[model samples]
Target: MAAVPMDDPGRTPSSYWAATAAAGPDIPPFDGSERADIAVIGAGYTGLSAALYLAERGFSVLVLDANEPGWGASGRNNGQVVAALKHEPHEIEERFGKERGGELIRTIGEGPDLVFGLIERYGMPCDARRSGILTAAHSAASLADLQRRVDVWARRGAPLRLMSRSELESQSGTAFYPGGCIDPRGGAINPLGYARGLAAAVLQQGGHIRRQAHVRSIRRAASGWQVMLDSGSVMASRVIVGTNGYTDDLWPGLKRTFLPARTPQIVSRPLRDNLRKSILPVGQIMSDTRYLTVGVRMHADGRLHLGGGGGTAGADRPALYEQLPREARRLFPQLGDIEWEFRWSGFMAMTPDRYPRLFELAPDIAASLGYSGRGICTATIMGRELARWAAGEAAIDELVLPASSFRTLPYYALRGPIVEGTVLFHSLRGRLKTPG
Candidate 1:
């Protein structure tokens, strides 16, 4: 791991997420004292989702963001609306106990349901297609791992099927996979469009959303929680912090439990319709089974988004991302003629348990962050649940990830180097490599 600037050059949105997505209507920052039933400290999916549910419940809600809504990971993700758990359910049951852990498993598997349902109900223009996700195994041992996952999910009544090499190659664009697993409930979408659409829906529901209101500090007030922005202040009965990897200086030690990582993506120039169809005829999105997975999706517009590997400001970013074009050429050699267009990156938070944390920082100030890389769907679902909880309408059982508490990472000051080193070694060794 190498040290780099906390901020980077042009770490904002780019790639296809920007091209097809519209910027959210700008909302002014908080300028004066304010009161609300709930104040959400982010305008990403988590905050927006919380606000949407809060508004529907007829609670007064205000959302504040440092930048435009969806400018964070919410808008700039791989857009793979996948629903399968990153870990197995039985393992979840083992860790958190059967009752609570099963609930968590069910919540995550239902994450995509919330996303697609919102898309249909709101008529969001995010290219919300309901196809399955395929995760491949590159080696025979990896195939055994897939078999274990298949058995585990099947025993838990999940709809998963393991595929042979032929089936894997058919679903994927190339013969890069020996085998894989498919989730019928999985899908993909235009993430930026989805975020913008959610903001619009939140506004239509009479919720208040403000941008450029970077929260400086959050403390408990005599009545509830006091959120102080750089320019203004707000008091709310409940506070929801959706800052995730950007959790930053607002809260000490919390961010250390989760590793902040940057994943890069590339979008090729649009292709011939025939070429696109040949690659993803069924319009499915795919990723590998490696610890750091590479997720790819063929768009309706004859383009593909290539994503995998992890790094950030502190570590030497991996060179694997540059291998995308060659990988794509292997997948569809005919794609050699298509010119490459945009390449960009976004940061995400990861927990060692590979599940998100939803806990209270104070009596009334709750936070929902640290989704690892499953942000596209999980963050939205967590946001909704967080809203319900804040409204006093939902219980801890509503949480998707087990809320069983653990000690915070021991060394807050040293976590970045520690986590980055661990990830860097495995990332380079390809020991964590997924089947493509």
Candidate 2:
């Protein structure tokens, strides 16, 4: 793993979302002992959503975070609300078996509905748009894979359409993609605003969120669990850890279970009306099929947001983001020398299988993390599943993704060099236009 310093809770990154989103709710840091039915660590989307649902179910929920809600990847993400996992529907069924896999597919496919439904229900101030999401194919192999995806989803009555080269070029305003597909269920949101909105909704539902409450350890107690903080302790019957990529030694070896990959993003100054009209005119978010996926989207205000997959460590430097502008120019050559105004990075936990996990760390302690690059929608739905399990409405085995023992990724410590090499290999392959 990387030797990066922990994020400073008091300082949110100067990303575009932080600058444009509304102010987060005024939350005080932990100051005194607290007790609740459930204690949640990390107030990202998963924790906040779980706390909100648990609070709604009349459980006393206490959420503690090193920083304010949405300060981590939850706030910094590109905000594309994709509804499916990395695998195709058939691949999922082949892996998890017919029954469980079918259930998982159905639940995951409804992820966008859960996200958009929450926004509508809470009347969140986030710029929520359900315009759609496009997956552009960078190669012929990728295009064929997309065709398979479209066929499977179409059989299931999903609102997905495979696009020809011309259609994709027209919609994305770029001739870079050979083909693509659009999932109308997916869309975009102001991620920071959405996280803040979730925090507000949790508070409104009587959930307690304490910011700057760095949890030092979790120990067993006669009552249940004791979450020791920098200045206070929280005792609850159960503990939920939703730290994702910011995960540390909070739980023994939890950080080793997944690889942490940094994703860097750059935002351009709002484009002129003519340029804006020429690019992504349909208001859809897009990501290509490259191994190092490049994500692009248009802000409601017309700023061009582009992100690239960073290596395993030390991805916070400005120099690491220089390629983004080049990529933007490659996609939209007409926008020559556009001034990029914001550059920032966040970590996403990558599991071996690229699927998020629900792990049973202890008798009453549950942890969920490793969203790969699909945190917005997956985390929201996972939080509800966690809430159901915590509330005893469903057993862990009956959850959508059953809780399982942690299987630490082998060679986890060497991830830095490993990821760098993999990135290099993929980059070379992509340059050569080799099959994926």
Candidate 3:
């Protein structure tokens, strides 16, 4: 196996998601040569879902991961299954053109339904809630931007509603938010459970999942493609690289296409009955308009979950845990002296344009990454599309998302400082605009 990186506080080795998810199959690592119709690297949602789809279609598929499935950001994310992207509608139109952009919008708009449908199809017991997602505005400027966003989606026939300050008070359990928009189509899920469930479904479909099977390299071969593992190699007609954020040098400069940002999350001890009812009364998932985003939700067991505080890429910051509780207290002052139960971190692949990209690296090798923190819904949908493309059921150009040429930042080594400095500026801007 490719040498796993050493543990770091900023890179959480375990999370609440893993602690709660049901035990998954102990699929052993690949030890020798194997032949398959398709070889998939990275056992996160993207890889597992692709394998599941392809295997169901009667293709021989093998998925290899350095660790157990969902060990990466897929299980460590904030768990909000939002159907929207960070890209503004006009921005998407400008980049992909009106015709393709409209298709892109329609594809992403179906993300939530795709996620929940898979959950139901498999009867996966992942504490999923389709109670809608609320985006609160931390400042008047952001509130205006959110209103514009709602108008765009509203015209598109989305079940979106704008809430006044008074209307948000009960929904958010705080009067701090003046106004915002809610998308009834979005929801939340136990991310780790979802990933594990995907793994189970993949296995049930006759797919192979090999944990600790790190892929070292991929090279084109006369037959198709050859994937080099730690001990043995696998030859296949097709290969899929789904290792977002945890992407390494296996595919040459793929890691340089985006910055891997670390987001720390904190979970509180289960709240009292009255306290839980007063907070997120409707049990809707929430996030605010601040540049440094905070996502809040209540677990099925009543433990309040809050995640945010983007920082330098995996550089240990002792203040992360402290800062979260302080911020949470500010948002819900009534809950004083709250006890934090868990603290962890996850890496998000952030692109300059804030849009996910699919790249056809070679004739038979493909990669999809850079979800920019909107992976849960988008990644699952991308996997299904990828399966269709891999199985030759769809053409490259005919895929819902067109493939893009890979581009890396110049002097990519300096992205850490660039990303950190940019986030600092935004955090300051957000603080100045919001009321204390």
Candidate 4:
């Protein structure tokens, strides 16, 4: 069966990233049968990064996407290059065991190094910044959690510092947060620009990317695998699925493994110079410790971008985004009246354990998704891990996240209503905890 399209599969969504990032490389759609050592589905950060690494290792790689590169969450994200996962270091270590969990924590903590290294190595002009990221606390309980996180990461020799309420107010120009913690390893980037730059690098490395080449299915062949597309097919020894939150039924039960939550973002018109300096004066990206976290960052062009939980509503509804502007005003009261220029929403997969999974769907076929909200750095690193597995440099068992079977979420069909209710509960809880 053909997969359901996510949004307009032919056109890129109108976003601040799309409006500012450079155009993607010109590539034609798949039109006939082809052979490659590796066939990858989805042309976002994960697929492109995998193909680039594979091509660099002298492997014949072909990537197929229903839309242009960076058309999905990779491009539409808030663009924060966060260096940690949804779970704290100790939590991960406790869940996965000391040895394996420690490896996971180390890998996640160093994720930003891989991201910035690639940007610098490829000369990607994504308005990349390493100013750091702040996890602000919305309440005293949240502040205690932030303190715990700081202590945990600090013990691991991470460059983290806890900020007092006064310090947070001075740095963020908002007295809303009681406290927070900053991680110097984290930063920001024009996510679409990074995605497009990765595509160009893949092309330069001799990898082929076909746009608007929606895959219909993947079937086991006499040898390797066959990727069936609307216009053509690809036969390869290995296949990687990197579709993330936009995943469909192309693979049985894959989409059911995680819940896709919509996150809506609003970008303001370039703030006046005084207002710009007053907010995020040091250029750090920030997300609070609310149950439904709110992200705040300044775009390269001086526009203020804010996003939070969007429930189950479609992106086209203007009402879905009204809360963002109000939240922005609450955070930065200095902006009495501000003009929002762009509003859009995208999905980020959520796992039961809130950790991204690497699944061995079948022999020689692997899929990775469910980054929660920390996709920018995690996805980039996941690509390199996938490439390693394909190149025989690392076995599935040796990969940082050892390959595991898919565990579909229970009551997956009711995810929409469940997520909506959860969002409502969190919204109310957050408002009560928020100081006036």
Candidate 5:
């Protein structure tokens, strides 16, 4: 087999989250042959959480990563802890049937709580907040959608409330939105810091996490599964693959299951206290109903962070960098002449159905990926579920989300134009929406 090239450990991503978050301790890469009861690939939130939980149960666990923990999407997202899936509730119920749909709803509804609970339990200093998440309506059509969302989630026992335009103006400090709703279960956090904290917790529990140890291949061995690295290998009873958007050819036909999307974010120099107060006054994380999905959050250091506009990785088109700042000034004119400080992008795996996928590839091998853009909370949920499944504490079918047989996307090579055209259409639709 050809050796798999790993991400550069010496390269640092340009991100406001990474620039300010505390650094984690040094972790060495795999050197020689090793044995473990369980091995996890991709040391992001899912792998680290699985390692921590499995180690707490006295199982020998090892985690391997192409880069350090959070160096991928886990470290580069907008940091919103959204609890709901990308699809509407009615759509989910119609697709999965009432009983199973309710199960899925309850599971996703508890995602944010699980994230915050872990932080508190481990005393992780990740700038986590449970203030809430507000989905604002930019037009009358969007407001109608929010109405349906509030009613649907309320029926499922969610603490959701529909706010008036006046309430939105007061809370969000802008009149651009007609109205919206707040999900008390949703919030925000420092995603990079959270990933590092999880790694620390895993180490404290005696789990081994090896940075720069990229898996080149996985095949059955006398021990159950053999994971091949560049300079060494590991024998394990079970393996969990959580590579997400960075998934490669480690497992045959695995990376074709989803489309990798590049979402860019822009940060401003610290806004004046008055300007910060007038925008996102209550400190709630906020996003609009545009198809392109505009979102903004206030950083702990008083800088404003905003994300939108999907494009290719490392493109850094001048047009793309101007998109967020232009929208920000339009919404909050107080943000005049914004001095942009940071511009970076993260890759999220977008499934055709926009739902996360879990697979039991073989009896001893399992994988989870494609959380859409809700990884801050859903990744944690998947990690814990993976650990439980590996430990025989829960069966795959009994898990919150259904496990699906591996399905590859048709015409996967044409994803570039397809994704770009789809995003362009969404942008046009967003521009057409004006409050009635």
Candidate 6:
């Protein structure tokens, strides 16, 4: 078994998702030889969903994970399945073009559909629900910008609802938000269950899954490629590196192309029945308009998840937690009285382009990594797109989204300093305007 990295406070190690996991199976370690048509190196949504789809296509597949499936970011995410990318529509059109951009929007706008569809198909009980997502605006400028987005989403038949300050206060249980827009199409789910269930579905479809199996290196074999592991090795016709932000120096230069920013989340003790019934009366997931976005939602267990914040391990958690209280209390004053029972965080990879990166590393070897922070749905979307590309269903250019080569940040080594400095600047600027 590959050495499991010790959980850090910034890694969301004590997840409510982990607390409720339904006896994750004790799959055997990869102690011996294995060969398959395809080998997937991570068992999160991207890797597991890829395994399921490939197995459905009658390919012999093997999935290897260093830890338990869904134990990484997949299990511990905020679980908000949003419809659009963080970008606005005209911006998307301006960036990728009207046709390709429109298709990407339409494809992922149904992101929640792909999520709930799999849940229903497999009869997986993962607290899947179509509760829409509300992007709350704390300022008038943010609300105006939100209004423009609501307009574009409406034009595309996304079924959004505009909330006034009164409606926002009523729903948010706090007056801090001036207003925001409601996305009727997006929703929430138990993300850990989604990833584990995907693994289960892949196994049911006759695929092999190996936990505690970590690929240490990848090299070209004669007809295919060979992956070296801590104990044994696997040879396969194709290999996919879905490690994302968890990616390391296993392959040089890949990690530099992506910024591994750490974001954390905390969950309050389960609310009483009355508070549960009142706070999320409409059953919508929510996030705020800050540059450092705060995502909040109620779980089926009746607890509220307050998610956002940045920095690396050890030194970062307390610093980030200090920034959370005001915004959290503002969104739900009821929360001001409740102490968080659990807190954790994880790192997500972001490319300079702000889009998921897909590239062919070599002939017959490819990688689809760096989904920014939208790995749950976006990663699954890319997995399916990748399956098609692998089976020759479409060429790389024929991909639903524009394909591009990778790039690096000139100040890659200084990202940590940049994060700390930016946060300091924003806080100072806020103080200057308020004279406090």
Clashing pairs in 6: 11-345, 12-344, 12-345
Tens digit of per-residue lDDT, candidate 1, span 1-436: 4232225442446568888876655577667778899999888889999999999888899998877788777877789887755776677788888887777777788888899999899889888888898887867787888898888778878898999999877767678778888988889888988988899889888899987777878887788888888887999988898988767666656666676777678888878876777786777888876676778888777777787655553633546366667657765676765677887767777777677888767667778788888887788888888977888976755665545353577655576676667667766665434344
Q: Which scores higher on lDDT, 4 or 5?
A: 4
Q: Candidate 3, which segments miss by more than 4 Å at Cα?
A: 1-12
**Tens-digit lDDT string for candidate 6 (224-305):** 9898888889999988777777776556677677767677788888888887776667778888766556787877778877
Clashing pairs in 4: none
Comparing 3 and 6 on lDDT, the stronger one = 3
Residue 202 lDDT (model 1): 90
Error at 214, model 5, angstroms: 0.9
Off by over 4 Å in 2: 5-10, 434-436
RMSD of each: 2.7, 1.6, 2.5, 2.0, 2.6, 3.3
Residue 291 Cα positional deviation in candidate 3, in Å, after optimal superposition: 2.4
Ranking by lDDT: 2, 4, 5, 3, 1, 6
Candidate 5 per-residue lDDT over residues 1-436, each given as its tens digit: 1111133233448788888888875788788889999999998888888888999999999999877888888888888998888878888888788888878888888989888988898888789989999998889877999999999988877889999999988998888888999988889888998998999889888999998787988999976999999889999999999999888889998888987777889999998888888888898999988767878888768899899755543344576566788788878887778688998876788888888999998888989999878787778888998999999898887777789879999856776766677787877777888563
The C-alpha TM-scores of every prediction are: 0.91, 0.97, 0.95, 0.97, 0.95, 0.92
TM-score, structure 6 vs. true: 0.92
Q: What is the number of backbone collisions in each predicted candidate, taken in the order shown?
A: 2, 0, 0, 0, 0, 3
Name the weakest run of 10 consecutive residues (lDDT summed) in model 3.
1-10
Show model 5 residue runs off by greater than 4 Å: 1-10, 313-318, 434-436
Candidate 4: regions farther than 4 A off: 1-5, 313-315
Best candidate (score: lDDT): 2
Worst 10 residues of 4 by lDDT: 1-10
Candidate 3 lDDT by residue in tens digits, 1-436: 1111213332325677767877766678677889899999998888988999999999999999887788888888889999878876767878889999988887888899999999999978678899999999888888888888888888888888889988887898878888888999999998988988899999999999888787889988889999998888999999999998888889899988888877788898899988888889898999988868789888878888899755556454576466678778888888888788888877788888778889888887888989988999889988998899899998767778878788987756876677778778877787787756
lDDT of 4: 0.86
